[model samples]
Target: MDVEKVFCMNGGLGENSYTQNSYLQKKGSDMVKHITLKSLEEAYVSTTPESLGIADLGCSSGQNTLSTIREMVEAIDKTTYKFSNITPPEYRVYLNDLPTNDFNAVFKILPDFYKELNTERHLWSQKLKSSIYIAGYPGTFYGRLFPDKCLHFIYSSYSLHWLSRIPPGLYDKEGHSINKGSFYISKSSSLQVSKAYLDQFQEDFSLFLQSRSKELQSGGRMVLILLGRRDRTHVDRGNSFLWELLSRSFATLVSKGEVEQEKVDEYDAHFYAPSKNELEHEVKKEGSFEMERFEMFEIEHYSGPYMSHGTAVARTIRAIQESMISQHFGEEILDNLFENYGNLIDEEMGIEEIKPTSFISVLKKL
Candidate 1:
């Protein structure tokens, strides 16, 4: 599959859009706001660049996209005044995501974003001397995306888990799928399936670090918040089980002849939730950045204000995975598939508590 073509969150501002369903991602960002701000401040103080370069990788469309950028700007603004006692540097912000991302939505909202920034500046009795220029950069982050030594602060949230492409070796020489009946690593998957995923992540993440190392200035800082696991185990009750529920939803569709079994067996999600050890190992081995801070937190699937936990989780997953699912399984099954998924989540929630885990890391470019 061409991941660049079909891999994108559900776009636009509709009920099922990522804009409406990204509260959980917002919450995780909030959890690490302090760390992100501190890291950015430190990077700015160290460099004192006349024109500050900041890039938000995997910055998808919506309020969350600009909201996070706004906060980072605010942090730099205050830090410049507090430490350097001078006007902030000229801001050059790059908002990046896949080419298929709904950049139109983001572009349309720029006026309001600028207005809000100006209003906040006035409310704080601050005289701005430097202008903030924002631009959209459409591309993948797994490779080079910027000029050498141009960025001082980089941020990516809830996006690193997505592999550059589906890992190879899921099928044999005869093209028979090995990870049948599951879209991700599961208890039933063979060891080869698990190793393939880990290898892909290692390659992608190392390339990510290498690319960013070239783009980042010395003493630059990058804050990464991604879905993660608590231990070395490839299969867990958190994200892995969520995929299990999704697989069961497909099974229900197949059983009713709504979708073909062959289609289901041949599909696999291009995502991996790595452990803390896995992240540390890669960072050390790559030798380009120093790990400043690392944290792990859990977001309960049932914490949303929706009428039911299942509805909330279902909406969130749909906003993220609908594009891929529709491209593969046909858009006709989305409603029934999510309905079945929500029901399964409700049943599972009644019996056991499930909370998805996330990680926040602060890396300083050496």
Candidate 2:
């Protein structure tokens, strides 16, 4: 399935990073620091490649993507001493994502990127020696995004679980009562939703491996930073928490006649949160790559009270709201909903609870 279709119904929440350029860039920079330092250390132990290149899968239109590129270039420059005998090889980068993603927005940021690089050159004589040229390509990483044996490093975050589309047999009736707010284990939730999501992830990830196995030169490395569950074998585990919260909110909306019950019922996210074991199993299944590191850690995110809502609006609340207020609920409704949701979260989790995000399962393709 086309990648865009998988993200078709996604609420604008993920896109919020496009507007908060600094936070997103900082995130990418941190990721680069972690991955690059590790990759360099690993290369020192094993056969080190003469050249290094990277691809950021799901590089959406935002500062995070640009920050990642900048960090990569800087790290490479600092690490050049490690390859003292050999000249730093040229870097070829491919930035990939869904076709609907705003590639032009990323392009708009490049001029500034060059300006920064030029500035860095003036500050550090070493920067003048590194030869790095970047190119951006918008496409689905579910398939090949580059020529055979072309990549040395690949990274993806918050992108792997989206199925190509909603499953065919699933649909909510017109009244929105039946399918309203059904998750993998809710009112309309069934094993089918969970299984379908998992099946698609496996299929898509398998294809991703097949593509990477051919694209990555021997000893190339790839890192997938995703939201992963702790237990893969837990039978009751699924998107149950999300379902519980969303269903309750929708049920409230239905009682108040704010939205059709059926409309809520019809909506289902075609996403899966794989457990670490599940992700590891899938990677081994392809028999193309070896795990270098597998770690799970959480990060804190401040959503001002909106994200706690767990309703439709929570999915799109940004760090800053500019003018897209119309696509979400009216300002008044959003305010009330967030107030209620915030109180509920405070009651349940206390005032200090932070949103948890999972880190990466770093892999090296041999």
Candidate 3:
């Protein structure tokens, strides 16, 4: 698949758009918001740069992207107050995603976001602050996007689990698709299938660091929150069991001749969750950044203040994956497929079930 062409969050504020369905991602970011604020705090205090340049890698179109920048800017204000009791520095924020991302949707909402941000700053600062410039950088994060030392702080959440591309060896010796029967690594997948994913992640992540190293100033901080496996055994280990049920739903469609079994077998998600060791190994291998903090935490399949209804989880996943899936499978069956997925997933959520966890890594450019 040409991920650069088809990969993107569902755009606009519609029901299926990521803007409306990204509660779990927002929750995870909220969980670590303080940590992110602290890193932003340190980015200013540690360097005292003339201007603050912040980048959100894989920053899809939504409030989630702007909200994160709002928090970072607020932190810069707070940290500046504590340090010098003076005006905040000039601000430059970069929102980056793939070339195919819905940048127009993001741009449409910028006026509102900027107004809200300045309103908050004016109330506290007692005077107008300098313009908080926002720019949309359309490109893949797999390579360098900015000049050397261009960014002082960076943040990415609910991304990074997406490999740059599908793994190389899904087709076995028979070349008929060794991983044909599964969407991702399952109990039945051969060892080769598992290693192919691990190797791809290691290569992609290492290159990710190398590219970022060129853009980040010395002492710049980065916080990356991504899906990851708790088990030290393999790369494709944790998915909140969301995929298993989705795959099961496909089997139901296959039984009714609504979908082809071979099509299901031929598809594997462009996703992988690495173990902590794997993450550490790649970072160290890349030789650009040093880990300051590494942690793993769990998030519910569906999370919010109110009791989440049955469809929230399914809607969220569908918003993110439906575009890619429709490109491979026909678009006609998505409604039925996710309906079945939601039913089974809702039925299967246990009160005490161990949900898939996210790996939070805080790094500093060396």
Candidate 4:
């Protein structure tokens, strides 16, 4: 499905804007530490690699990899220290993301990892005892992101909902589907669009679980963190406030002749929010792993205070498209969307901060 081109549509996590942006970095740093701590606790209970093979799927390229790897190495160290008699094994860690990502960022970090390894070796007889082998790969996760049973541990964050691509049937010469059966297609009411995204997510996630089941060792583990919705009712999918805002906003766009009526009616995904139940349902369908832990919590996503609602609106949209602002929305359309967001946010009921709930789930392969 030309995943390379589609996945490459966005600059990947390496885009200089957010890839290196301070806001995401700070959040990710904390998130990875928490993730590894949990994964390690689980791994300690079940599996000890005579040699360990770990992977960070959709890892992107940057300091984030270091956080996970460091935690992994530490966990192994602590475990070996407690066991004393068992020799710590060689470690092979594969860092992965889409093909178009900046591998250079990963390569640049490797020398530093090894240099520290060598330095530590001399200071203490078995310091940083494991032999570390790090490599990078570019591939779509939907279809065998790695080799069969090749990984002992896997981790991914903030990347699962992105479908390999927007669904083909939904996009026409103008845009994508708006209303199908019970789906909403308005700019502010993009339930149909969000549903499309959810469908694609289910498809992709199911495939991910199936692939991991094949690629993960019998006792391997996986952890994923993603934005999710709180509502579990069938009707709630249609009632998401974010979707409603987007639908109404787009409806305004169509009414004012600012955006194509058909275009607004056709496509969805102004914002994608999925419920935990939906995610759990898909993962269970894969039948490859036992769910060890699932936690959902709300985090205030602040773009910071802006001078005015319009400025805030601009900042908000820019955050999403900073890397490929021109590709997804042409200059004029993007400008219009921002204006709409500003106007909408300033309205009495509009939200200044997006408080989406994100979830972290951990699983152990049987």
Candidate 5:
């Protein structure tokens, strides 16, 4: 599959859209907001650029996208006034994502976004001394996305875990998949399967650091938040269990003849949840940035007042995974698939807790 052309969250403002189902992601972003603001302040004070260039990589469409950017801008604005007693710099903001992402959804809300931003600025002072120019950049973050030494502060939340592509070598000498029964690494997967996933993450993350290193100006700061595992084991009680449940859902479909077993065997998820040690090793190996801060936080999955725990979790996963799954398995079975997924989740909730952990890292270009 062409990942750039096929990968994206479910779009629009419908019930299943990412816009509505991203509360968990929003919570994760809030958990790291202080780190992001602190990093932005340091980047601003160090470089003191007249025009602050900021980029949000993997910036999918929704309120979370602009809300996070607004917070960063506001933080810098306050920092500039406190230190220099002068107007903040003009803002050049780049919002980036895959080519197939719903740029239209983000663009549609810009008028309201700009209006709100202008109103907020007016409240601070009568004069609007600084301007923010926002533009959408469509591409993958695994390679170069900006001009050399241009960006000042970079931010990405809950997005780096997505691999640029499914890891190679999942198949054997005769081209049969080694991870046949699972879409992701699980307790049942062989050591070779775990190694392949980790190898892919190291390659992709190294390239990410290399590309951003070239684009960021000297003394620039980058704050990254991504899903991570707490232990050295390939399987975790959180994300891995979710995938296992989905795998069971697929098995149910296959048995009932609603989906094909061969297609299930051939498919693999283009994602990885790295351990903290793995992240530290890659940062040291890349040799371009200094790690200023590293933190890990966990968010529990719970039932909302209006929905069951299973339903809430199912919608969240569907909003993120439906696009890729639909492309591979056909869209017809999505409803039944997720129904089974939700039921399986409900069955498991009584047995164990579900809490996904995430990592927040602050890196400064040397």
Candidate 6:
């Protein structure tokens, strides 16, 4: 199935909702605030549009998107002070995601967001000032969403790892999954399995660049805060094996009459973690954008008030992966699956969690 049709973060403001479970992604946005601010500085000083067009691509709804937008607006405000000729920017904000995403959930929270924005505006200055207007764009980012040369800035966070579709060549001559038992590109996989995934990312990411190249005005910049890997040479085992534990959970059901082994065999997560070198290479190959900055850093996972280390880890994984997994493995398996997955984490790991590497990149449209 295409990720566009099936994938989305857990919706609503419930405990399992992405809004509650996305602590690490929130931290990611905070860690990369400098990149967003820098991009705004360059974009405003160069283009200086009276109204800035900003698109937050793959913008999963939660409390986070609004704060990020506020931060960007603050960045724009800071930029305006340095330029005497430049007036305060009126922001046209576009929040985009797949059509299946929970846009209603996103929209439902807007009154509060507007109140906060108004409060901030009043606090920032007593004078009549710039304004922000937000709209929803429901579509995948692998293709163009906006008209040519309109968007001045684009931001995507903890996305871009999702391929537009499952990698081709996953099934063999007999039409069975060749990547049996492995849900992702594991260290032990054959070169063919690895190459299949690499090819898909290459094609999808190139198409992404091509699409955005058409949308961004000259000097327009994009800041992508992404999930990535540490080693330039390999998809590290620690990074790729989260799904491995989940698959083992299915194995317990396969032992009974609960799930077919074939179902387990056919699971592929439709996700890939690329290294910084691969991103740079793709940008060079596309030739439509130049890389301004690329930094990879690590984030340590943790437990919180609502859950333990193992439970928090499982919830975090579920918020992103549950919909897809439920579609394939049956929703009935979800509770048990996560329970066993959490148990596995407790047995193998301790209080301290391994840090997952993430990347922040800034690219300028040529």
In order, the Cα lDDT scores of the candidates are 0.91, 0.59, 0.84, 0.62, 0.90, 0.83
True lDDT of residue 162, candidate 6: 87
- Per-residue accuracy of model 6 over 1-366 as CA lDDT, tens digit each: 767888999998887789888887887788778878888778877888988999999999887888898888877786776667768878999999998888888799888888888788768765427788999999999988999888999999988988888888687888777788888876667788878888899999999999999999999999998878876655554567566777777888888778898888888878888888889999999999989988888766564676666687788888999889999888998888888888877765764455567889999999
The TM-score obtained by model 3 is 0.95
* TM-score of model number 5: 0.97
In angstroms, what RMSD does candidate 3 have relative to the true structure? 2.0
What TM-score would candidate 4 get against the native?
0.76
Backbone collision tally, model 2: 10
Task: Encode model 2's per-residue lDDT on 1-366: one tens digit a residue.
Answer: 233533422213254334442342245337546865577445423544556667888776666777667766666666664566655556667888777666777787788887887688548755345556667776777787788877777877666755555444354344232333564445445655556567777787788888988988778777777655666432322234533554565467668877665555555555566777777787889998998887776544434443443322243322222122223334444454444444444443453443334657678876
Clashes in each model (backbone N, CA, C under 3 Å)? 0, 10, 1, 17, 0, 0
How well does each candidate superpose onto the true structure, as a TM-score? Answer: 0.97, 0.78, 0.95, 0.76, 0.97, 0.95
Q: Which regions of candidate 2 fall more than 4 Å away from where they truly are?
A: 1-17, 21-33, 40-51, 168-180, 184-188, 233-240, 301-347, 351-357
What lDDT, from 0 to 1, does candidate 2 have?
0.59
Error of 5 at 227 (Å): 0.5
Q: What RMSD does each model have against the real structure?
A: 1.2, 5.2, 2.0, 4.9, 1.3, 1.8
Judging by TM-score, tell me the better candidate of 3 and 5. Answer: 5
How displaced is residue 337 in candidate 4, in Å? 5.7
Top lDDT hit: 1
Give every collision pair in model 3: 180-265
Candidate 3, residues 1-366: lDDT per residue as tens digits? 888889888888897898998888998888888888888888778888778899999899888888888878877787777755556788999999998788898899899998888999999976447779999998888888999898999899988999888887776667567776678887777898888888888888888999989999999999999998887654332483677778898999999999989898878888888889899988888888999988888765565565443478788889999889999997999899988887876677643343777988999999
Cα error, candidate 4, residue 189 (Å): 4.7
Worst-scoring 10-residue span by lDDT in model 4: 180-189
